[model samples]
Target: MTIERIRVLGLGKVGELVAHLLGGAGFEVAGGDLRPRPDLGFPVDVFDVGDPESLRSELDGFDAVVSCLPYDRNLGVAEAAAVAGLHYFDLTEDVPTTTRIRELAVGSDVVMAPQCGLAPGLVGIVGSSLADGLTDLRRMQLRVGALPQHPSGVLGYAFTWSPEGVINEYINDCEVIRDGHRQLVPAMADIETVVISGDRLEAFATSGGLGTLCETYDGRIRHLDYKTLRYPGHCDAIRFLLDELALRDRRELAGEILVNAKPPVDDDVVYLYAAVEGQGPDGLTRREYVRAWQPIEIAGRMWRAISWTTAASACGVVELVARGAVPGKGFLRQEDVSFDDLLSTPTGSLFRDEVAVA
Candidate 1:
């Protein structure tokens, strides 16, 4: 259960930060990418991520492997980790990918946890904690948004994270518990207005943000759902691109076009909101946790809010596994993660600190 050495796959924005945070927390960390990244302050291994044999060979000596690769590249990395008998973690929001990883975890000696990032990871943890305090859980609503502090153009968005991932979430079918029944609904179908910190925003159904909470809370909570928040009118613009323009049929091209139009922004804000309504000791009650996080200084360097928040959530879960605070074998569920334990870790404390709202 003592994880000393970790091998991080991919050296992108979130991946690099994850390695840095784990190293700062006293883990011997190294990185692997298609290109050389010697400037990451750790050893870097250049290898073909698509080749399964190379991936398994690279993961041999590490106690665990964290895959920050794109959602499509994670299954191979996860398979390699399983073969090496290493605990595995990933930031994938793809439902089919997580389902396959769950199959890999069965009867395995190491843990296989996926979806350990912002919406599916942190928001799931927060929502579950709030639900635990209630008697008759009626509804659980979770929302998260990563956007530029200032915006222009019709979209009013930036690609602070992966453009491919965003496009996948936008067009995929969402799973939710509606009217006490588990069902799949089209993404962007249910739109609602949400206000946070005097800012008016819109939220709509998104795929994979709920993680495993739909199954975990099925038949217990009357209504359970998750959504991605955006500035008003943003959803309409995206729908026009995917539906009216027929870009949903060509997701790769859509991603390329969107990223070209709205590149990643340095000054970004991450908004998180979770509310649980049920029966309390007094009567019907509602409990909510809301926070607005901005870019932060860590390890003497500034990190984008989206990057740090996602990295912190992944690293915090890894830290918990290292300390035996959670299960070390089989599949790990984000809803099962204790929010208090996450806040106690060095990486998770980054979320504990607040920043001025933009």
Candidate 2:
């Protein structure tokens, strides 16, 4: 049977990008958002995710649904998609939300895939692909960041994407496999510095980057961790506010302060670097480096690095589903797609040659 069409839920930056990318690739793409979006430049139906009956009606006639809504709202959309028998995909990093989606996928006829952005998305795919070939893995580190190309503020960052996600990354408890034990480490801890592509960058513990790798590689890898990369002094300042000022307890007020204070930007850069060292049959070997950065332009628009990576990564997975490259049922992880498969995909191929390592 010919696939009918692909519907993207949420017309935010990421959702809009997904719609355009998929539409341009020949899929009949439609979009839904809670609020009317005049800036979308295309007609997008307004659909309330909170109203299940309305959401189900809106999702009808589509072969798949890609949610770009907040992490908390994703499960509702996923449920609506399942009831409609449409494939489901999202860019959420919240572990609990993802667990609920997985449960919703049980005995379903459609697929449910989440964490399709930079860290939980391509980083998991690339990092796990490297680990798959290793024997006796010792230490694995994954670092990803999206920052403005030019900074004029003291924070040295821009609100290119979700501010709530940024706050969650800073304040949420992080998962780390240290000394052969899985444990929770407070976010923004374990600060460290590294150089990528001749530029100095700082990295620290962040939530949700590991995805399910901790469970997948548990008791096998000695030390495995994921960190968010940032410019110098970025982590220190954030830590000062979230920790020293005790803003973690007041995320809403902190988010307001950040949104009103720090401006967003269009010209931005995304940094992705992973290192895996282990002993193999031949001896000791380490695969460590960064991907070559390729600026992205979509729908005659140029987005900052964060927008490019996050949106493209998600659209790539949607393309995979449309082509039957992924399972049609059950929960899906980002690591399920190999680097080769991702590079071969029409949407994901854009990053195949763009990765550079130090």
Candidate 3:
């Protein structure tokens, strides 16, 4: 159960950080991408994701594989993990891709865990912890967002994470539990303003943020939803592109335009917020958790808020699984993890604090 080696798939913003974090955490980490990124200062192999033969071969020796690739490109890596008898983890928020991984994990000995980043990963863990005290849980709301430390663009946002994932979130229907039933809600349809510490931000429904919590809390909770937090006008501009400009059908082009227009920022802030309301032991109760994290220097390297948080989440889960803290079989959900256990790890402690998890 001791994980001495791990393979990280992809070497982009989050992937590179994952390699650094895992390496520093004393794991023999090898990063793989379609192209070589030697500057990462780790052993990186070149392999095309479309070529399953090469992927499975590249993944053969690792104890676990963490896919930081775009959500669309995760299945091949998951399959490669299955073929290699290694534990599988990914940061995908795509519901269909997750379903595919679940189907692939069935009857397999290796563990399969998806949605191991930010909203879908940490938020779900926090949600479960918060709901534990509620005698009759009525509602739960999860919101997360990463923005430039100093906002200047007309969109008031920067390229914090994957552009493809952002566009997919905008165009896809969000899954939520309402009236004690699962339903698909339109993304960006419900816009609400929230004020935290003098900064007023807006939140809107976004797809795949809920992970598997809807199914876990369906009949137990009356209402549950997840949304993305952004500056006041950010959602409106994205809605314009997807709805008015007819970019919904042309997601690739839309992603290119957005990525081309926005410059990536290393200095950024990530926002986390969760609200729970229900009848506790005494009476009707309500509690909320809020935290704003800034770019932090870790292990002698500086990383953006989004990069560190996203990578930490995936690494944290794999670390637990590698240490025999988590099961190594079938599909796993975010709600299956323990928040306290996650915080005790070196990687997950990046988000540990009274403010971060309060």
Candidate 4:
């Protein structure tokens, strides 16, 4: 069989990384973005994401469309992909948008996979894979953080990804399964401290990180939650701003504040830690733990850990779908991915070796 051809939408840092990884894997790669991006290292076909007809025209003749754009724009892209009968994938962590995409996927001829990035993407896969091995699953906790390698700020965090997306996760409603019941909890409300790899970190409920897992494991598990990890004191500061200052009601203002205050950097680290505890076949309790510490590198260019992991994971799933590894129709969740299949893919192998060492 011939290699699949893909067209990646959005030419941001993550989009560029997707194009490079797919191109290296012997796929004919093309890119499309709203604005002209000359630094993408290859020709970027200009197409406005806001224009649905134009997007449909650009996406023609491609096996799949990988969207690295923000969450708000993903619905349109998914619609375009479905209409064109091309597989659709994105790195969104927004709840409502993902819900819409799921609705769009019903009875469609092409696959629609959203939330294919770090927390909602690989973390969900790893956690669910662990859950699959247990005889009687009890609890599952997933924590992921993309932190600056070197910190010098009040928040001790950098804008490694989308500032708006970060704000959405911080302030939006989170879906969690508590006491074997699916519940919606406010983000930044259930703050807790955790120690990983000898470094103290903070974690709290974050929106869109669970990616349909609460419903997937609703009655089977006593607890299932996903949190975003940050350095010590980061949650408190955000809580004060979002809760005390009433910034949660004003998400646009909150996003602007984060954009203006936090600095974007190329030197960052992505941390993933997931733990699942349940009963074993021997009538003994067992636990499965997966941890990954991936640092940033971009061949010769500068790319942060968040950028590399988030972008690569999305592109990796797209590659898998194009190569006929994933089902071609209906709604797809991150947890549906197989661990072995993921490790064999070119871009997905980046996390595979890292997790092996951890």
Candidate 5:
């Protein structure tokens, strides 16, 4: 279907920017949230997103709907989109939620794409692109971080993204491929140091970051893993909270406490690194792609690095689906998206303008 009128649910930081980018791309974008949002450059409605019937009613006459609500609320929105016969998209990293969406898309005609955020989204695309050029692929490592530019705390982090999502990834079991077999490992285990652009950061296994890559590359790649990058001592501090303090059992309180501690920051940086190792025509070799992205001006305003990057990646896929550059039917995997095609889109090309790290 040709996408024109698009409805965006949830008008938080990332959702607002997603609507902005989609509107800039020439799509008729309307947004919905719990409270009324004024002067968003598009029409917005205040309604109950939790009710599937209300959401389905709101989705009528729209060619597509983008859910930027919390991961838990996306399934209801996806079901509403299915009922409305409209294309569905979301930026969720919740495994169970994506699994249900996949089940919903089994025989559906509209496209259902989830986990269109940074690690699971763009990193998967980059890793797959690297693997496509190798003869004997041995391993693929993907890492990403969103941190304060000038950190001054024990955790050395700022809540650039959702606090609940961050806590979920930290406490859940991570999926990986080890020794050519799929396996489940504990989150925050197997910590390692990663050096990118002269910055020393620690990386550890995180759940939902791999998306469907473990299933896609199982037995094909010898070992495949994805990790979240943080400054030194961050993992230890988090372990103290989740393990030693026994806060893992009470995730809601834990999220509230952590968010109270390290709130969102305006000046932040996002670091991404992807490496592939395999046998080429000559011999064993490695290929890598690394970048440090900072906040920049977009549509006459400066946005957080994490905010724009996430919005750009999410909207880029939407633009591609609208143009038929990406598949318009059934489930859409982020790994299946072409990196070159993503970069060619108006919003996806934002990744090309990286900050020069010293």
Candidate 6:
């Protein structure tokens, strides 16, 4: 799979960055959005996501399609890309969407990989890597947060990422492996606190972040869970909207309210924490991987911490699959990618060695 040309879907925050990074990385990259995109100094085109012919023309002659479209829209793009004889990758965190993609991957010659962003992306790769070394795997915990370095507002949060994604996690039931059995847990429950970089943050169960890890490690691990970290009091405020206001039943309104109210911030941070403990050759031991990323300037422009991380994760894999490092066919999982190999990718190396809390 020598990828000489690539097509990126969506020109939103993360999609724009993905196109920029891929272009700078020396790939022949073109970007498409439902509407015309501004001249970002790269090749961008406009197409309707709902029109099959539009997607076909937008994605024509590209070796791969990196979907930054909303989760609900990815299936169509993926089917189009498969028809175009191109590999399909996405940043979606929706479980049902991934399941649909998995079904589409069957008997297809190209790769169909979704949930390639952070949390469901790198976090799974790291957690599985650590769990692989345990002599007797017991419990694994993953926590990630994209937060404002300086927090304010009544919600104590700003949209450094997708507001709809935040709402989806709040209302959906999370899947976790408990007592060696797959279990469904309510979202935004199981409040806990973790101190990273000396900043105390709250964490709770979140849907879709776990991806396929539970099924991949099912019947083997005792306890496994993934949670989202936020500043103290953040979860309670979200709970009020979901429970007290009954906004869970009114997702469209809740999404709009949060999107209109919680403004996006450029000054943001991404916190990562993964820990696994169990019996080892020597004894029971624990190893943790932690990171805190700040916004940085790239290609003569600044990218939010979330934007860069999320895009880089997907773009990095594009390189790996092009080089034949990953399986070219069948549905893929983040755990299917090797941690060391992923870290060796240009984008994966960005978070490999850096300043993270000890």
Q: List the residue pairs that clash in candidate 3.
A: none
> How far off is residue 224 in model 1, in Å?
0.6
> 1-358 in candidate 2: lDDT tens per residue?
1345888887876778888777877788888987887776456888688998888888888888888887778888887887788888889888888888888889877788888988788898889888777889998889898877776566788777778878877888999899999999988888898787787878899899888889888999899999998888888888788878999888877877887787677777888888798886678888875764545766577766676677778888777766778775788888787777777776777786575665
lDDT of each residue in 287-357, candidate 4, tens digit only = 55646455645577666677778877886787777677878678889988876787788888877556432
**Structural similarity to truth (TM-score) of each candidate:** 0.98, 0.94, 0.96, 0.94, 0.98, 0.96
| 1-358 per-residue lDDT for model 1 (tens digits) | 5699999998898999999999999999999999998677999999988997788788888999999998999999898888888999999999999999999999988889999999799999999998886877889999999999998799999998888899999989999998889999999988999998998989999999999999999889889999999999999999999989999999999999999999998999899999999998899999889999989999789999999999999999999999989998999999889999999999998877874343
Shift in Å, residue 342, candidate 2? 0.8
Backbone clashes, each candidate: 0, 7, 0, 0, 0, 0
Candidate achieving higher lDDT, 2 or 6: 6
- Clashing residue pairs found in predicted model 6: none
Which one wins by TM-score: 3 or 5? 5
Candidates 3 and 4 compared by lDDT, better number:
3
Q: What stretches of model 1 exceed 4 Å from their correct place?
A: 355-358
By summed lDDT, which 10 consecutive residues of candidate 1 come out lowest?
349-358
lDDT of 5 by residue, 242-349 (tens): 989999998888889998999999999999899999988779989888889999999799999999999999999999999998888899999989988999999999
Q: How far does residue 324 in candidate 3 sit from its true spot (Å)?
A: 1.8
lDDT of each: 0.92, 0.81, 0.86, 0.82, 0.90, 0.86
Q: In angstroms, give how far residue 285 of model 2 lies from its true place.
A: 1.0
Location of the lowest summed lDDT over 10 successive residues in candidate 6 = 347-356
Worst 10 residues of 4 by lDDT: 287-296
Q: Which one wins on lDDT? A: 1
The runs of at least 3 residues in candidate 6 whose Cα sits more than 4 Å from the true structure, single-residue gaps closed, are none
Comparing 2 and 6 by TM-score, which wins? 6
